[model samples]
Target: MTLVYFPSHFKRAPAIFFFAFFLFTLGVTHFFGGSVSLLQAGESKAGLPYIVKKGDSLGEIALRYNVSVTAIKKWNKLTGDKIFEGQRLRIEPFPLHSYTVKSGDTLSEIALASNIPVSRLRELNKITGDRIYTGQKLQLVNDRKRTEKPSVHVVEKGESLWDIAKQYDISIAAIKKRNHLKTEVITPGMTLSLKEVPEEKHAKEKTDEEDPELFEYKVRPGDNLSTIAERFDVAVSLLKQLNGLKENRIYPGQTLQLRPTSLDEAVHVVRSGETLSSIAFKYRMNVSDIKRINEIEGSKIVVGQELRLKGAKPNVYIVERGDALWEVAQAYGMRVEELKRLNGLTSDRIYPGQELQLGIAPARPFGTYTVKKGDYLGRIARLHQMSVADLKSMNNMKTALIYPGDQLKVTPFLQQGSEWLKISEINWDDLMGSSGGLKKITLGNGPYYGSRPMARRQNNRRYYESARLSLWNTYKRAQKLQAALDRKIAKMGRLSDCLNGWHIVIDPGHGGLDPGAVVANLDGNGDKVYVVEDEYVYDVALRVYVMLRLHGADVTLTLLSPDHLIRHSDPPVQTFVNEKNEVYNSRAFNRGNSRSHWPKGGRNGNLSRRVAIAENAFKNVPRNRRMLLSFHADIDHSSPNVPLVLYYRNRRTGRPDRASKQFAKAIQPFLGAGTVIRGQNVFVLRNSPADISVMLELRNLAYTDHAWALRFEELRQRDAEKVVRGVVEYVKGKG
Candidate 1:
């Protein structure tokens, strides 16, 4: 080796070299440390396992990670866009392994080298076929080892090969290949190698007969033949054959043969637009069977989820708490007798957590069948080979009434004993008279209570008997009257009867602080006066309320006069004190912000509160006998419009409700000749709990004649009377 000597400043050569080395070392350290710190910060900011902070939204997080909100939701299985602080989210997709094509490398060769299925590789890269090019970067799923050594799974009772694969997050084919098994059958108490096994070595192993190892498992709670087969990675058929079982009946503490059988376990990954029912149809498996194997509590699943397509047997149901045999049969669309026959049930008695074997039968298609013209309940029932009572029970019908274009269930199972009568059995005379032993009280613009008379009398026993008889007589008379009215209405083809015994709820749109469509007008003194929509509608509603009550129709108002107190201030805002002693601005109610303003009963803000009040009244009344009418006055600036009626229709079917349309059409003639009955999906009518709901936009305040009519009490009374006539027609038509 030859050495070169430094000539200039030779005395400090060693010191110079030492200082240069120190500076170089410091620079290297700083550069590497900074790079590491930056990498860690980037990971913390937005990456896998990101800890959510306050004010973090899904959109913000998605933007940070360059991902879509939909992708994030899919990854997290979120049904809605709601997240809370401190919740951790997966901000990044799973890391993909990249493979660069080299010379002499083919797609199949690369996939084999990586020990991944060729189909999987193609799926990951979106490749159509075996086409490839050199130096191409192909994205691949990461094949990282889950564990250092493969873990052994002990066979359990009611376990199947598919179940084992799902538990270990491995494919059924992979498990079968690792165990050197031709079939998916495995018995309980048998130890199986989860790691890959050499085919030659597995072949060399002794057979079950030569080993003579006692392979038996005791059944436990929630164990049935299907579940046991799933737990042991075996087929239910093999278990039955080995145990000499003629049926799917199994009990706890029972011992069964633990031998492997021949069956293939198929795995399927859920995709978008797939439902449990559809999945079951694809696999030719019963929906309940699929649910049982997966231990699913509800019929909800997310995309990209791995599901077991095999090992699900048909007609096996695990009894849930509060489950009755009849209910179970109905849920499966099977008759009670058929269910009993399949299960060999001698009695209707069944307990919670009991497993029943519903033997496989040919699948029957259950769907809606449209009612054609001239079809009656009895006729349809006969066509479907069901009784009228059964048909009514299946369709939840309160009356034996069906109309053309109505979609009715063709093969729906009847619910056991949950039917309610359309009309109540009450004596009108006993309820209205003093001696008949029942008294009624007025509450909230309607009769509320009907109770036994409290007054003491010498003939108390006679009075009680007389009241009972009177009630029965009254019920019979009302039924007869309703039948007669139905026939008359059918013959007349018009509504022209008093709305007696009908329950009606009237909702006046906009009240209190919500002026609603304020229009400037001149008073008698030439001062500007504001004609608010709420005040006019309220006045008209009051008149209608009185008219309906006079005709013996039960009436309820969403907002009473006492609740519509207004204070004329500079801002012209209304205020009210709630039960909690909180003063809330009525303006906030109109804006639907009253909940935040009051914190108590604030949800009853403005329009929503009015809707809730109407719904509550409807609930208090009977279902078919109740109707809701919302009154509103519109201001049209473009053109002069006449009075119009609006009603809601089913959005999915695009068909207006028959009753609501009839009610609207009945009132149209009374409003004017040019009045139009429109189908509108308004908030009140669309969401009302009543069977029939209608909204009346009485007259346009912008028009001269309409404004004059509303301003005069006599004209308003005339409109109210027309409305009463329309309602009477509707009630008569319903009968």
Candidate 2:
């Protein structure tokens, strides 16, 4: 609190001295490997060590180096919330929510340490395959706490945890953890622990940081800036900046980007000569990365298509024929003249051979900055080496319009701690393994719908009342994960060459804990006959796994043996139970002795038991390059229920495509020998994620008729083969 007033007579002298001292200090800083401010606004230097690229999203950039999009935007004083290729983004010296794969650390272990979901970890790091190798950089996406924190303010009269969390740029979880509170309630004068964090908590905290919640998105054929931005809660301007839009456009064969907090999600891009393997290699990523990014249950990438590349750097746009210079400049936030100058041109005329810079153009101003999660304008300036006014001027921002994916210009500086460190090389095979989004499109007229026919439910005549509730519950869970899966798959799908590479985890239901049906003693001996559900499912799953492997698919099985899976309270089951009783309608409970028989554990040898086991197994299988198949033996004693199959469908809305039902169709024919009924009321068959899931009921395995049992193995093997065939076909079409 010391204030000295300037003397009137010496005012000019003091001003001159101050100016000289400032200049001298600035010179010394630069001479000593420090940065000098070349910008009139924004921070004085870039902190993180990476550069934003074309097809890059704010979330991807943040996850790459374990920072927050908000922090990055704040540091850069970014307006319009955009990023560009070649635009330098600040990185902390050591990342908080990231790890360099150690020799023994599995993906699951890494995810656990970072307090992030395994699926999120896979998507954040663009892992296309299973396994993590030594020296691989894996991102844990739960580190938003580093960038976003609760603020500490004296509680006034009436305040809630939600209100407090909102007040301070932090989440309710953070506040609860900081204050050691049991619930989100607060009391006056309690001195609640607020997350009054610094500008870039993600960068500031270097160790033991949890991963932030992250989402994945698949690139679609007609995806563009506006559509993706709208879906993910991101600004269109920000998307353009992160992706380095040489032209504000996107194609079908590319991936998308996303974050936990961003409304508009993240995305990726497609490149020439890029296969799943190549894409994985270039990004030090995996084929699974491509699959996850593109949301291709089967590997498929159309020409000029856009997939999802969540964690990898945004893609670069190659100069193409019939392009305009102005369009390019506007897309990348550069002057038309700058484009001309960068390409050594005097006029606007351009050529394909010129290879105009597609991503962020070169020549960035310097500065030091920290990124914040969910950061907006007005807050970034306070934490960095720039003033708010300066930031506006430097970034050419008229208002406080900013988003998470912006890079700011700043003065240069010497080496200091950063959230990101430079990595010179990336090994693709070690990171992504062989899995991606390259599949063939069935343009020909032979069985245009592939193996399984659309479920009988599509006809809308035989919708089961109780079954609809059961299916809707399961479908809701899948839908909840759909957005995230889409983001991951889109990234993997862009590599057409990588289409042949696919890591597929297939789950066949009714193993271990689930015995679906029970039979009574006809002789009156009071002895009960238990039919084993696991036996059939185990056989089917194994065959499918083998067939898929033989067909060049990298396949993993949820239960290779009866004992491989146990009845567990996780995943689809958990999701179903969590729903309101009204939504969790189940016919099994209404069946005689169903509730008592279908408890949590023990091999009951019933169809319901088998279904539960399969469902539980799916819960255990991580959401990376995966699909779930609940195999059942149908039993409809009366004609009312008949013997038809069903596939789940999402309520009609903006999202189109039979993602759920198609999977059922893919495997239906193999099970048709028992009883062929087509329908769409099954919950397991709804519009779920790219971990394509469906329920296949072998027509009459439960019937006493020997014909049903005779066809059991045939149906099992065929179903397995079909699953494999479908995956292979998908890969071929995409590749």
Best by TM-score: 1
Candidate lDDT (C-alpha), each: 0.48, 0.37
Model 1 Cα displacement at 344 (Å)?
69
How well does model 1 score by local distance difference test? 0.48
- lDDT, model 1, position 141: 49
lDDT of 1 by residue, 1-735 (tens): 000001111122222122222221111111110112111112222234556779978887765443467878877888899999998776543221466677656675455333345787898788989898888878654345222322345455567988777655679998776554679888864545455533343234443212211234555567788766654433465466455567998765455554422111133334333578656754556899876655454786543233454433455654422234554565566776787667644434332223467777545435477886655564455334343444676677876668889998765422222232111121222322222122334321222123222321111111211122222233333233323322332332111125655688888776444434443322222232345566567667866765566556777766533211111111111111111211221222323333233212223553555566666666667668888888887653221234567789667776677678867755554453234466767777877878788988886654323443354343454466557756765566556
Which runs in model 2 stand beyond 4 Å of their true positions? 1-499, 519-530, 560-626, 637-645, 650-657, 663-688, 706-715, 726-735
Instruction: Write candidate 2's Cα lDDT for 1-735 as tens digits.
Output: 000011111122222122222222111111000111111001211232566668988876654433457667766777656778898755532223355676655664444334345677788878876677889977643443334221233343456777666545468897676554667666653444343333343334332222111122334566776766654433454344334345776665333333211101122223222345534543445788667544344553321123344432343333222223443454354676776555544434332212355446555345645443444332344223233444566677765556555676543321211332211111212222211221211221111111111221111112111212223333333233222322333343121222234455454544323433321101111121222343345445545544444334554443322011111111100100111111111233223433333222334333343334344444545554455555554333221111234455435542223544444433332222112224344443443333565665543322222112212332334344434434444444334
All predictions: root-mean-square deviation over Cα?
30.8, 29.7
Question: Lowest lDDT 10-mer window, candidate 2?
Answer: 571-580
Report the error of model 1 at residue 293, Å: 86
Off by over 4 Å in 1: 1-497, 524-527, 563-606, 637-640, 650-653
